[model samples]
Target: MTWNCGNLSSKLATEEEYKIYVDGSYLDGKIGYGLVVLKDDKVIDELSGYVSDPDAQDSRQVGGELVATKEAIRWCQSRGIKRVAIYYDLDNIKKWATGEYKTRKPLTQNFKEFIDSTNIKISWHKVKAHTGVKWNERADELAKAGANSQGATKKNGLVDDLEEKAKKFSDYLQRRGYSVNYKGIYNSQAAKLSLDDGFQDIGHLNIYNTKKLHLVPKYHELRDKSKQSELEELWQEFLG
Candidate 1:
């Protein structure tokens, strides 16, 4: 099923239209999706869950988005909403949805069918990611929470709910009057935590830094082995 809006003009939706923000979170072997339904800037409901045992071929970041989008359509249809807008942060979604991109991926093809079948006047809106948009940020946090709940890692022989930890750490920062960025990490010099505190609060930072380490094209491995500080510095530099 495709969006067959033959004569329906595309434009920014208003407050009267139901709005749903969807985001996906992925880890080593798990995927989670978060959805927030809203109207008039007030939340109507939220939904989140992990994709159980996704096939290796379908267990990708885009797979999570496809699942979430498919469910969002069903949710809107169930509500009998005549007009709705579904917001996502991925540019790739636009390409796929608009028929500008195609692949043999089962999930993508299946999602097209799902969209074509849903009976609702819908529009797709792509938003800038991790920019602190309220509902979008909440959806992201929910996705992370779902991921942690489903596939929480073992640390010191105990289950570590990194998403929950991230949420609480973000709350602490807020209570301390520290401005938390959309990624749930504070970047302000005045509010910045020490390296130890940073790692403790933002567990994903270590993952991100570690990923950067592996992305090096080799030859500089030794020099960059001790450059975690430099990596973070570069991240902050990018943020600026």
Candidate 2:
């Protein structure tokens, strides 16, 4: 989703109104949502819980975001609150609710319907993630905590194995005096590896289908064919 800072209105709401920051996390097949409620810029409540649904597994982190917003709306309705502001990181959270984007998936359709049926007045604000935003960061931390609470489940063992291999490969490159950063997304069936030279990115690696791996040189003009061959040989050795 595109990231943009939405307008933050100058006229702030009164103490009677609520401001809620919501986030979701997905890890190793576990999904969780976190919500932080505030009034008059003071924390009033914090909520976090795991989601155990097959549909959520398909939507991944976005599913958790939907659940968090849904929970926030319920909290406001229960307290007889009329006005509230929702701070979110994902653009679809606001787009689906405001009809700026169409909801094709069943989970998203359900979420949009829930928002449409809610009586409470809701305003949405987009916040850039991991940018030192206090409540937003807190919400992310809580979401991760909730996901960790689920522990390990009977998910895709192959994906987990691939992730472990990716980590080992990253360490192998690091030991050879190369700067490496690896990230594995469980649901995507791929791992991304970036190789840097302490100044600029030198190359990238992608493991696809959990078996096939590809290395792409970042600057083909600057690097010779021998360096590319070396990286290929190293990958082959690691795989063997």
Candidate 3:
């Protein structure tokens, strides 16, 4: 355990004794990844970051953890923590971290940079979360705080393609007189899956209040098939 030695403690941290535990919490109902490094119940380092809607199109936490995990790796490396035992509440993170999911979030060059430069060795462990494991709980709190931080939507104009896509989905919903709220996103997604998995093409979906409305994509297709009018000559009509 690091005593209260102020700034000197960090510089004097010995490699053999520099053990760290890493974990993350993504946005609620989404993956907001967060990690905390502890040396005998004392916090040496922590990091939290998220992947969220650019236009606040929806709160998609699962995707955000991919971004967070990348950041977590960078965080660990910057601090010179070479020997790490990374823990996650979700087994999927372990799977993704250890290369079980091949088609996981696409990594940027910066991600590759971290991977190539590090002598850090990461070992993953799955912990029983919300079970009062002191450091784990602290990690949860840290992750939630990061996930909920105010950057869910920031228009830098650099995100040309994604912004366009998000806007297209936004415009489609608006034309249908449907407004986006948390429940609406899920309901829309569920209704989309009910139509075809491509229903998520509309945007993030949440079915929290699905009973109140009938968001049937089949109905949309039948009623507004003309929306497909912009298609090529082959689809001038359904059977064409």
Candidate 4:
């Protein structure tokens, strides 16, 4: 199976010796489901399947977990990772893999096949939900972001201006080898990242009453720190 765009990006962030976490939620006999991915407490990508299994009647039925795990496995395999740990709140999935349970649906079974198809060493851990863990918090953000993945609609007038400003800030971040995340709350609420000497807070630049301009990204390199100010200047000139 192929990955949704958000899943891929979320997986990429965890590349090369990073902790990876994946979460999925489904409702209504698996009619609507979404997945969230995280790396090192940062959101990489998320995806909600556009599945229309209308015949399903169980609204509480969760269908997206297996596919999400499949993508997670893909992420692990592609990186040639030999060992990793995953967290799942649901015990059935862990049990199924451990041969403790069985499901009639091929979803988790297919995931089992995918797991067997690979030689990587993986471990699953169960963590308490809503307990304020790092992985859980990050996963929550990713899942929520995925749920809103229809793409943010372009706003008009003032909203447009704020978005543009956010983009400009994000561009400035990218020029420094940092991935900009503009969808989170703007009051530094989502920033779990640390900036090197070359970075500046520049304060929150709000494009609207409800928005503050706290845009930060990971850019850490001793050699590159000096250029941070220069890029900031260019960003000002371009956005001015």
Which predicted model would earn the best TM-score?
2
- lDDT score at residue 20, model 4, on the 0-100 scale: 50
Give lDDT tens digits, candidate 2, residues 217-237.
222433333456667677778
Better of 1 and 4 by TM-score: 1
**Local lDDT at 184 for model 2:** 45
Off by over 4 Å in 1: 1-10, 56-58, 151-240
TM-score of each predicted structure versus truth = 0.56, 0.58, 0.44, 0.45
Clashes of each: 4, 0, 18, 7
> Which digits, one per residue and each the tens of the lDDT, describe model 1 over residues 56-160?
225555666766775676566445566677888977765676676784676666555444444456677778889988888888887777666663433311112
lDDT of each: 0.54, 0.71, 0.43, 0.45
How far off is residue 2 in model 3, in Å?
27
What are the per-residue Cα lDDT tens digits for candidate 4 across 1-240? Answer: 122122344454344344455555443223323444555555665544322222222323244444445446545543555655566555575666655677456555544545554445556656676688776555545544443432342233334344435544543454444433334234423322222222443232223323453333333432445555765565566556
**Comparison by TM-score, 1 against 2, better one:** 2
Give me candidate 3's TM-score against the actual structure. 0.44
